[model samples]
Target: MSVDEVAALSLTEVAHKIAAKELSAVEVTEASLQRIERHNEALNCIANVNAEDALAQAQKADERLAKGGPVGPLHGVPLAHKDMYYRAGRVSACGSKIRADYVPDITSTALKKLDAAGALEVARLQMVEFATGPTGHNEMAGTPRNPWNTDHITGGSSSGSGSAVAGRMVYGALGSDTGGSIRIPAYCNGLVGMKATYGRVSRYGAMPLSFSLDHVGPLCRTVRDCAVFTQVIAGNDPDDPTTSREPVGDYLADIEGGVSGLRLGVPTNHFFDDVDDEVREAIQESISIYEKLGAEIVEVEVPGIKHGFALGEVLGRVEAATYHSTWLRERPEDYGTQTRNRLMQGFYYPGTRYIEALNLRGQLLSGFTDEVFSVADILIAPSVPMAVPTIADTDISANQGFLDMIARFGSCTRPFNFLGLPALGVPCGFTGNGLPTGYQIVGRSFDEATLFRAARAFERETGCTENAPVL
Candidate 1:
């Protein structure tokens, strides 16, 4: 296949070609490297490119293929990691200047899983500083521009993961979600982003902004591609005691099951309020499509939805402050403006408030399960309240515009993290302004397969998965 053809192929298709001996692993790796070189300057997506290591790994994969050796499911696939994920010898800056020179001695469990699955890590993508903010703005490393529009923000934390995947620089990439890091960018850049149940995917070696809310998942071009990546990475790990002992389900099996007879809950109050008219319309249209596919739409109230965000904010801030306390005290100037301001605010949160927030989580979770799931199998809402905004439009000075933007964009997503549910952002339709709008499909705890099935069904019915940014 030509470089263009190879770059455009999905992860599943690439794996098939490699397994069939129709495409060499080196060919795909080289194509991805070349594409990164051509576009990274303009997009500023890739923070670190490991071309030599990737080629070496690719060569080994090709040798294994020639020997007819048993290979992992994703053999010879080229992929990237979010810069925040540690890779042993590589520096994990976490988009902060403080850690720009700090290198870890262990690789992230997520990266290890991808590597074991026969994926070559070609590069590390840029992200928001300390994964704190939602917009892709980074004063130290530079912002990752959206592939759809050079002027628009790429969304945050998982910023480069979304941009690179959407721009076809790599087949897929791993991203961490604290609030909405994964889903926001996924929606803004026209890709699929899954925030697995908090403990479903191990967080070992990935920089943590909030211990209770952090989740690692894949951002890819299609739902099946995300599933393929997730299947390789989701499971118990000895290193991460938080990882559940429950067996990982067959994510790809029966994924084409139509949404017929599935109960999809639409939260009428918190999720719909303050959403853009275009995004609201797109989400309604997506629900209608699912209903036409034999799914039942029920209006259900997600009890404590607003309170979930507030509690998440409290816990996230406290945990983040705990992690960065030493550095924050000693090297305060090394941090970026947005990250510093956000982390500092944790100092103001009283001990009683933090404990109260933690205590409230259980009650909120119980209410959500009892009230919401009683009526619906999965909850659906808009991923972001508004379309992708221009980088110039946001004030990164921790001003009113910046705070308001974060609250609005993250309003629909933060609640899920607090509830510890699996949530996915899938491209459903485009706004009248030509930007992509995503619908969030959330499932019960550890029920990512159900969410994936619903997302895949909607994607197939709408035929929007194939749409890419004009860039």
Candidate 2:
């Protein structure tokens, strides 16, 4: 296959080629590295590239193939990790000045799983300051440009992962989602980003944003590719007590199944309100496609979604402040204006308010389970209320617009984090200007298999997965 064809192949297809000896792991790794070299300067998607290490690993993968040794599912596939994820001896800035030079002694649980599956991490992708913001504009590390439109923002804090995956710099990358960080960028950049059920994937060694809300997942060009990545990462971890003991289902095995007879709940109240005209049209179009695919779409009511967002905000800020309290006091000036100001606001949350938010969260989750699942198998809605704003438009350097953007993006995504549900953001359509729009498919807790299958079916019908940004 040509380089473009090879680069465009899904992770599963690449693995199949490698197993058949039709393609060498070294060749796949080299192609990804070349793509990075060609696009990284303009996009700023990759913060660190470890070409030498990746190639060495690829060579070993080739040796294993030559010996006919057993290899894992993702064997010989090239991948990247968000800069926030810990890789021993590698600087994990977490998009902050305080920890800019900090390197952890241990690798993150997600990275360990990727490594076990034979995924070679070719680079470290850029992210928001401590995974705090939605826009990809990181003042400390230069903003990661959206590959679709260099002028538009790549949603963050998983900015680089979205940009790189959309730009086809690597087959897939790990991204952490606290509040739509993964899905927002995935939507804006035209990629499939999956935030597995909280604790479905371990967060050990990942730079913590909010311990309760943090989830590590994959951003890829296709829904099935996200499923493949999740299969390798999802499971119980001794290092993380929050991880679920439930078995990780066979995600890829169910991708070809259509969503026929599946009841999909459409929440037209909070999520559909305040969306851009283009985004609204795209979501309606996506719903039509789902209807055509034999899926039942019913309008469902979520009574406490707004309240759930409020609770998540209180908990996230309080927890985030607790983590950064010492740094905020000692080196407040080191943080960006947006980061410092937000962290400072967290300090003002009363002890009673934090406890109340936690209690409210439990009530909201129980209500969500009874209310949302009562009429449908999964809840579907637009991932973001609007298309990506211009980097110049969203004042990431300012305190107000930064906070406003975070609140707006999190309004739709944070509730799921609180409910501990599995949500997948799949590219639905493009806006008039050609920027991508995504629709989120949220499944019951630990039911990522259903979400992935539904997303893949939608992807097939819409042909959005085949679209990539030109670099």
Candidate 3:
């Protein structure tokens, strides 16, 4: 295959090729780096391109493989990540001016796991300021333009991860989701992104947004790829006490198990409240496909999600303000205007409400899961409520309507974050306006395998994923 073709290969394809020695780690790394150089200016999906370091790592991988050592599953596959994941000595901007020159002294457990698995990280992707926004806008670092249509938003926090993966500059990217950061971009850019059950992955060495809500996950082109990446980076971490001690299942093993006979829930309440015709139709089409595949669709009264977004907003803002209290107080001028405006709201919230929200989480998770999962193995809903909005339309910095638009954009996703359930964003179809949209498959806590099985079944039947955004 040509260099561009090599660069465009998905994560599993790249891993298989490199593992078989049909392609060298150097070749894959170089191909991705070349793609990044050619396309990054327009996409701006990456913040710091680690050309020299990546190539050196690639060379080392080649030497190790040549010596016939046990190979890492990701050996030599080049990947990029949102700027929030810290790597010792590498700049992790977190898409904020305050951290513009900050470099962490330690690497995130997730990155270390990926590194041990032989994934070569090629770049640090862009993000919203302190990962505070839902839209891919960062006035301090500039918003990353959508690869499919540069005029649109790439979705936020995980903005660059979506852009880079969709643009075919990287195999996959690490992204954090507190309030839809991972899924929003996955929906907008047409990729697969999963916010694993909270505490499923370690948060050690990663930047904090909301200590209670932040989750780390991947954005990839397919369900299998999402499963593959998640496998390597998931499970217990001594550094992170919040991490689940439950053994990491082989996500790929049962992925092809398909969704046959599984009960999929469609919430009759909150999920579809503001869903547009196009959004509703695409997801319905996916549901119809699943129905034909023998998956049972059950409509259920799934309550509590209605309160999830607002509760998450309160917790996130309060925790964020607390985390950045020093920064917000000391370097108030460092944050983007929109981020500052948003973060400052945390300060005004009553501490009693924050505690009440925190205390209510377990009851909420219990009630919601008991009701929904009791009737369904998985829950399916639209990832984005409306058609993917243009960057200008969602730009809170420029538009007056964005205040309402932001909440609506995250309406479906925020609840999962609050509930700490595993949710995957699967690209099902494109909107009439030519932008991308998808359905979210939320699984029971620690049951990401079900989410993958269901999504992979849909993907196989529909062939929804697209490569090489029309940049």
List the candidates' TM-scores in order. Answer: 0.99, 0.98, 0.98
Give the poorly placed runs of model 1, Cα more than 4 Å off. none
> Which of candidates 2 and 3 reaches a greater lDDT?
3
What lDDT tens digits, residue by residue, belong to model 1 across residues 344-393?
Answer: 87888999999999899989999999998888999998889998788888
> Can you write out model 2's per-residue Cα lDDT over 1-471, one digit (the tens) per residue?
767778888888898998898999999999999888988899998988999999999999999989989899899999988898898898998877888889889988889988888889999989988888888778788889999999998998899998988888889999999888889889889888999998899999899989989999999888888898989999999999999899988998878899999999998689988888989898888888989999999999987998888888888889999999999888988888877787777888899999998878778888888998988999998789987778888754556666776788777888888777889998887888778887898988889999988888887887889887777
| Candidate 3 colliding pairs | none
Backbone clashes in candidate 3 total 0
Q: Give the TM-score of candidate 2.
A: 0.98
Distance from true position, residue 209, model 1, in Å?
Answer: 0.8
Clashes of each: 0, 0, 0
Q: How far is each candidate from the true structure, as Cα RMSD in Å? A: 1.0, 1.2, 1.2
CA lDDT of each prediction against the hidden true structure: 0.90, 0.87, 0.89
